[model samples]
Target chain A: MKINNLFVWLKQKPRIAFFMCLPLILMVACLIIYPFFYSIFLATLNKAETKFVGLANFLFLFKRETFWLVVQQSIFFALVAVFFKALIGFIAAHSINELPSKGQRKWRGMLLIPWVIPPALSTLGWWWLFEPTYSALNWLLEKLSVDAIPWLSETFWARFSIILVNIWVGAPFFLIMYLAALKSIPEDLYEAASIDGANYWQKLFFITLPMMKNIISITILFSIIVTFANFDIVRVLTRGGPIDTTHLFATYAFRVGIESGDIPLGAAVSLFMFPVLAVLSFIILRNVRKRTNEV
Target chain B: MADVEIKDLHKIFDRTEAVRGIDLSIKDKEFVILVGPSGCGKSTVLRMIAGLEEVTEGDIYIGDKLVNDIPPKDRDIAMVFQSYALYPHMTVFENMSFGLRLRKFSKEDIKKRVEEAAKVLGISELLKRRPRQLSGGQRQRVAMGRAIVRNPKVFLFDEPLSNLDAKMRGQMRIEIKRVHQHLKTTTIYVTHDQVEAMTLADRVVVMKDGKIEQIGTPDEIYNFPRTGFVAGFIGSPAMNFIPGNIVKNKNGYSVFINKQISFYLDKEKEKKLEGLDGKDVLLGIRPEHINEKKSEDAIEYDVKIDLVEPLGMETMVYFTINKVQLCGRVSPENNLMSNNKATLNFNKNKFHIIDPKTDKVI
Candidate 1:
């Protein structure tokens, strides 16, 4: 006679693995999946939460000029910041790598200081640096006879200031990643290229770049995600000032959902980034998988 | 003019001297090998010649032009590294043609040179394969092919076969020798393997402690080593060294061992040891010099075989003399056994008497 016992079945090896994973699964369910679903529900609800207004909140967000502005600003901010971060990171990694190994260690430690500090804390320091009257950078520029220009109050300069701060915080991560990639290249390959009549630039093109193709793609992908959702730098530096020109998805959502108390509309606005992000992530991840498999 | 000339070359890293004042001139088509133990600066010397390393204090001339200030790119030399150093991303063809393409060789000329080198290396069919797709031996051949396509003024190899298995190493050794013969280009090879030095080089340079111990043809290095180090380092199973003395005897003088056996020094050997009588010296006995009583006039010793290794062609016999393990070679037909007494014949004329204080052979 067979007893269909659930407890006995749960004692099996596969079931034990599942049981070991139960805490993380339960945490994800309660903390992440539940909120996600609740946000979706909130996006479809009427203002009083008594009636369903499916797609109306979304339609409302789609029609707003400020919402579209946030979309453009978010993409532009992420792309420009990631690009400069990658460029600075590669150049820094190369110059540091060229130093003797002892110097390389010291410089690497110094460059990584910004990354080691918490983003919010570092953003606060940057806010002080970008302060309109007491700005150290403007003081230096004025000392050099340059005219004083608005950093946070202007439309263009505010976006530029936020991107610059984002780059300062994020470039070190790229520096570490690219340095690791550069070190992974065999020293002998460079020597061989030297004997084969390749100068520095030739070696960089034929040997270094090809070897680092995968790391560059992967780092850019990772930085894009982090920068696209970035809030600390923008909030500290500009707070979407100068006519809300620099409002990104995260800061705009905070303004609407938490600050202005339009919870359902804010949820709908926040969810607007999801589909684009999903498609971009899917494309890039597939490309990364294909490239890594090649290696 | 000589193809390569190094004058009182020296290289020091930090405080440690890697290559101390050394002078060597290589003929236009000669194949010279620098053989030494690791950290002895043989590879450092080769790298200096290739301009990969800066000479701490000396001049290196290539083709009558002082090349000390030239970068490696203009050194007109191609090097094969121990790791093969092929571009992993490039196909075999692209890897071989890279230098040509960089140098602005015509398309047809690059193709011809690459195909010819590939044919010479027996890798014609592997042109499209990437380095990761090739086996260790094929990768080695491709590396050599990459060098061969250039037909540079000099070829430098830094332990190119060190990464290969023993079988592949032997095969590549023969292939390298054949290529050297075919190309007749000036070549310099560096290795820690004495067998490679003995078998490959037109002349071998033995180094120790960052200085050249001796430079000679293979036969001279094997038969007439100038120092005790060279004598001991050049042979397999190593040259057995026994401490002894030359004492005056009724019939001229004899090398006296530990009451086991002594033979009168020949006139030639006696002349070589003129002032060393009654002085302590190291007697260099190669394993091949000691056999199973080959001649009646040879000094005979009843040595208790401590260990017997029966190689297919020879039997290696080991015994302790003054706490120094001495190795001797006998025919495998002798069928020697361990823990048994066997009389070994020491070739009296072949004794290399060394003044232990100077470490120099008489």
Candidate 2:
């Protein structure tokens, strides 16, 4: 009888529960769902100066000469940068994990300095190094009896510079994540594997990698999404320069919207990033769910 | 299949000597259990023998081959961990087959071996299921199955039944004994539970403070413990120790409890204490040896019953005599109750006497 009465009392407290959730519901409605639908509405319609032109902005984007070139370059940059970042990050994390606790902390702090430094400040220093004349790289090359090389002015050089900057800035995030994942594994598992006749390499392949599979998949998907939309480092270093060879979706949208003042076209270009982000997020969420199930 | 010998095995962990100069030998096909309380270094010794732990200043031999530098794999031993440590991602079949697969065994060989081990453990129907999907007892069988399939020369179990509930622990105990009987592998098990050690061990090596206190059969350890630590650690409800001096009374030598109760020494113990008259001694008695009702050859004592625990067939009566609280076993049919004044009797012939200073049997 008391249990039933308590249940009835809980049911009658809807007003209290509703008031408790009011702030949270309002925050979500105002911040997330509101802006989401608003962006879709804005993407569908043209700006003030131009009337509503359904799919015309998207068609114009496809017809543009620079769009295909920028798309190709962006794909190459994101893929190469993400691939190297994962490899180098995994290697660094493994090496750091092998060190003694104090040594690991020291090396980790030292390696993370690049990530802690402001990207704009670091890219400004990089800009000076890539200057056409009086550059430190050119000075080094001259000392080696080599001719001065064009680094940032040329299309390929700009692309390479942006990819290098992306790797430098992004690898540390993955290294930190992988290091945490490595430490989270129970030490007993390795001890057990060693007792079961596994050598160092066998332990690595069978235990370490399999244990880190979930972390690696989620981290890779996350890196791909972030690198695909990355703009700050590339914009500061290359400014989408050398015929827009370093332009990713983020910088391309910035150029079309702010630099070129083509609001409709810019919105369409930025909207192009939506499908990619959505697909990547879906993959990441699926991978996370799978990882939890594995645990 | 292997006789393991340890000579002066010492392990120092951060200035704490975990295993201090231990020397012992385990015969072939012998189920030797290293039993002790926590931090007694029994597990450390087992790991050292398995080659999983580095030996600081000793040599270990398995079947006449020096394994001081050999890896656990080269030592040809299989270990069942306390956690079971079954690969969560692998099915029971795969987990059992892993060791075989690592040795480059053929597909048919791995299948046959895994199937045979599963059959032995009665886990054949659950072979295809992952470890996380199985209950604790089933997982324990899978762990044992994993070890059995290896056909290793030596088998090591580190508190393998410590995680199970009491009933499950008893069940697994019987299962392990049955498996050991059939396989007859050279097994070394480490456990803090004396009951497991007593039931499972062919010879129990009682350890304390990183040293072997005594090594003997279960009966020897229970009937005669070399040290006070072993005496207190080896029995359920633990043997009670009453500190007093052995005085030459008119009747014979009696251990007087200072105006509370007096126990006359038996002939064998009295003979051993012939030269040590008037010396301080400790009277050790198991709970079962003390009864609430008097018998023909028992020394009577008036005890205040503080608590009564009815354990189905038998009841344990907790009481105090001479400010020392001790447990006495009584029949459940006696209807023992709490806070009741009672007269209990000690079986003086079965009592053990130890020198207080040396802690050795007098």
Candidate 3:
């Protein structure tokens, strides 16, 4: 009788569609929402977990030089890597777009190999390539009548190595996305631009770039968020080494929270990323919304 | 504006020959329309003339300059696409001025040209609005404004009015003619609509299956079509074809449609069909050429009316004679009834004799 009543209720009210989505809502709450507030609660606790410290952990991180260094490095790492990734990806996508259709499939498959491989496994291979004594790049340098240079031993080189590897792995995502955006544009726009007496660079600036602005902005925002919280490459390649100069928020939080057993301090360091990300996302999303409405 | 000459032009995509050896010449400041069915390669010919498509086996001459190897940007052509193809991000002013700015025009010159074109198109108030904010007709004007600001040597339109409603299409057709009169640019318009072809084209080039079927003025194409395809394609309610055999008569020749119907040809038509006697031919008669009232010299045939459609201006009468369905235009005052016998007069002087083997008018 209750089953019959429930079926009748489902038939009468379309609002029951909300009930059908309840399981997914509950799962998200348990997995994502619960951990989010729990991390904030953990960030406010003392070391011993007996009483709330009331921003003490955040105050402590603000006073540390290493913390400030990590902050600066994190911003620099995300900005530089994302910029190069977007640039190389855009150029590669245009090159692929210009190739004959038969040749494009082969090039696209080869370029996407780095993105398809597991990040942890690929970073390990990069780590081996940057090894101090047996690096392949250094060996090549030696054969070219140049001295063997340290790849991971020095501060600047280690930072460069990690940023280079980040670009290598992340660039394929941008390539695929930009390629899809390029394909979505109608063919007639280019033909129209050509008939308008536009050169190649003019077509790129006036037609191609303006058409791709929305996708570019959203892709950059997403890549920024992912790159800022990145931990696997730094963890596998340098492990926040070379005097901890390459430590990002994720690695620094791991170093403080898990390695040093200061969970509250680690939570506090990771929580700092949220506000920055929130502001960036809010600005980008608002711009995207405005652009969408304009169109 | 300059004249365009296409010599033995062809375009091949893989194995499919899209355009097969088309040769055409346009006089300076002439408005030519390429009209055909969907796969007839009219658009392909336009694109080749614009240098957007590579000519596989011929040369294109714009103002006596061989332009087969020239890129589209150097061809000094402007095309208004069917979709308008406006830069969605730019205001109407920017869209119109994009080409001039690309050529490194000074700011004052760019503004002058864009404003002049916009004012001519009567879109001055819409310069600040984006394309998506405008109506379809407004967007179409902006596209034309973009093309006009460059003042290119040649103007190409690829079914630009196919996207608009019937009312707007009629309105824009006059505007396009007016623009051509004012600018006097060598314009080439392509469309599949015969009405648009008739109303707008100074001369029409009819195409069929990668080849030019006929090219003539609109009046000649409507009245004296060179091929049966053009005769059938250019008219509303379409010209009807009735299979018949030309038989030699004592005095002249008569077309024997069936045992129940036959008509004698006049002196001029008989001379034209002198040697073609006893050959199978198809009679082409437009719907308007078959009338309801019988005249003194009109040949009358009895037919069973199948349907009667009242279209306010005239009524269309549908009937079948010898298993061939045909439409005839009649005055609504007749009050024709369906499923009844009615005699329709055939305007013998307006008939066409088509040789069925070659689908050509003889």
Residue-level lDDT of model 2, residues A187-247, one tens digit each, is 7667777777888898888878887888888888899988898878878877788778778
Q: Report the lDDT tens digits of candidate 3 across residue range A1-295.
A: 9999888878855558778788999999999899889989999999877789999999999999999999999999999999999999999999999998899999999999999999999999988888988898888898998988788878899999999999999999999999999998888888888877777888898889988988898899989999999999999988899889889999999999999999988999999999989988998889888977865
| Model 3 bad stretches (over 4 Å) | A1-18, A287-295, B268-275
Q: Which residue pairs show backbone clashes in model 2?
A: none
| Displacement of the residue A161 alpha carbon in candidate 1, Å | 0.5
lDDT of 2 by residue, B1-362 (tens): 88999999899987999999888999999999999989999999988887878999888999999999988888889998999988876788988888888889999999998899888899999988998899999999999998899899999999999899999999999999999999999999999999999999999999988989999999999998888888999998989988778889788888875765666767766677887778888888899989866788787877779999999989999987667889999888878689988888888777677887788877
Interface RMSD of each: 0.5, 1.2, 1.1
Clashing pairs in 1: none
DockQ-sorted candidate list, best first: 1, 3, 2
**Local accuracy of candidate 3 as per-residue lDDT tens digits, B1-362:** 99999888888989999999898999999999999999999999998888888888888999989999899888888989999999888999999998888888999999999999988989999999999899999999999999999999999999999999999999999999999999999999999999989998889999999999999999999999989999999989899899899999787888888776687777776767867889989899999989876776577888889999999999999998768999999999888889988888988777789998888897
* Error of model 2, residue B239, in angstroms: 0.5
- Estimated TM-score per prediction? 0.95, 0.91, 0.95
RMSD of each: 2.5, 4.2, 2.1
CAPRI tier of model 2: medium
**What is residue B247's positional error in candidate 1, in angstroms?**
1.3
RMSD of 1: 2.5
